[model samples]
Target: TEHEVQRWPLEPQGSTSFGLSRDGRFALLYSEEHHLVLWDLEQNKKLATLGELDADGNAVSHIRISDNGRFAVTAGQMNFAVWDLGWTQAQGLWSISDALIRDIDITSNGEQVLLGLSNGKAIYVNLVTGRRLEFLAHREKVNSVAISPNGRFALTGGNDYKAYLWDTESGQLLRTF
Candidate 1:
């Protein structure tokens, strides 16, 4: 079977980063001009442009969309922003004072986020409760992070040549690879 391919042009031209929802219904595009545009793939229409420039007037370099298409996360060097797609408003904007954010992933419900940091730590934030737990299993920069669909577990990998699975709430190490 051959699938038809369609080209959709985007505004503000040069996009440096892009992310799509797990269900393939939404897309997040970050352009070179620091514009974050959201699109509804199924409807073929623009949803919203999100995020704001930081103190230095620089936006994020990385972007991720939640599995349910309810949320999006954008990360720059030291700060990250979370947006509620349904409301088209920012849920939170936070900065990590000591460590740089290397990667991020949000839970399907959009209530939590797992952030990988340069200090080899993975931090989990409960958006609703405002509680944070840190997983300290890696010894080098944490390069990647993921949260399970149920938001019970987190998986993280780093430059230390290892990957770890952790209990998101308890911060207990489950397995290492």
Candidate 2:
């Protein structure tokens, strides 16, 4: 299994995290200082670097890209932000109330964003309208989350040692393990 693709010399210092668009055309890398960088994979060039004013002042825990590549989302320092890549001036931005976002997943259509929080909470937001669909509480922080390719279901794992499957459209708890 050799996917050995071209390697770009990323940042030399600072703990960082990465995210790839669903279609694999775009990517994002963040430094420990909450520095955000957008990369164009197809062009193999750096597309944008979100400056200090654009990124949160502190470090981020995780990041995710929408399926349609219209938006980029990140969680950090008690904040969850949404970025509109297509817009030129400070794209769309928003914050979550509880701010425990640890891991995130986007729907294939890019209309919905799901977040797993550090406080054992799960949040599902409708990106298109910036509305919250569900706020699920857990006993421990959520560690990871994934949405089915078909957009039919979502699975979330938490430090509470549990995983849950939910209906994407209806926001119903489908199963738990």
Candidate 3:
């Protein structure tokens, strides 16, 4: 048998949440201190910070890593930030809508993002083109958003006791449950 492990400090682990890269080489750590730290598990240490601090230094409420481990999205107070994990280390920050972001998820190809908002809006953002499409998704705050495994659709649930299915490319409502 074989074993794999890394040293993640237990001290000050304030309200921590994490995302592991698909290849299992790295981990992204977010804490209540308003910081996101990337760790190189193979080498057993921190790699770099995922993104710059927000204006108000708000703690990250939600985050998702792409299927290839090449991209990540962090939900900010008034917007969301996408991080390019490629060597070039580029990033895109978008304030596509004014609704308060409640949660977010990146697609398998890392091309788009679906965000659930407190304003009852489900926003789809094109990461490469920076295009946005937002529509009223619920009567109250949306609790979650998920991309289908085949990448053809999205599912979003809210406080209104409903879950919606949306076309990934067109952002059109496909079903209600």
**Which regions of candidate 2 are displaced past 4 Å?**
1-6, 32-34, 52-56, 88-90, 128-130, 135-137, 148-152
What is the C-alpha lDDT profile of model 3 across 89-135, one tens digit per residue?
Answer: 53766774567888888877667888888888888777668677875
Q: Write the per-residue lDDT of candidate 2 for residues 1-177, one digit (tens) a residue.
A: 889766766666754678888788888878855378888888878888874323437666677877777776666746656676776224455566675668887665556677787777777777667677664746888889886645567888987788998886777888889
Query: Mind giving the per-residue lDDT tens digits that candidate 1 earns over 78-163?
Result: 88888888898887778888698999998877788899999988999998898999888799999999998778999999999999
Report the error of model 1 at residue 50, Å.
Answer: 2.0
Name the lDDT value of residue 154 in candidate 2: 81
Report the Cα lDDT for residue 39, model 1: 90
Q: How close is candidate 3 to the true structure, as a TM-score?
A: 0.79
Candidate 2 structure, TM-score to reference = 0.77
Clashing residue pairs, candidate 3?
none
- Please give the CA lDDT of all the candidate structures: 0.84, 0.71, 0.74
Clashes of 3: 0
Off by over 4 Å in 1: 1-4, 51-55
A best-first ranking of the candidates according to their TM-score comes to 1, 3, 2
Scored by Cα lDDT, where does model 3 land?
0.74
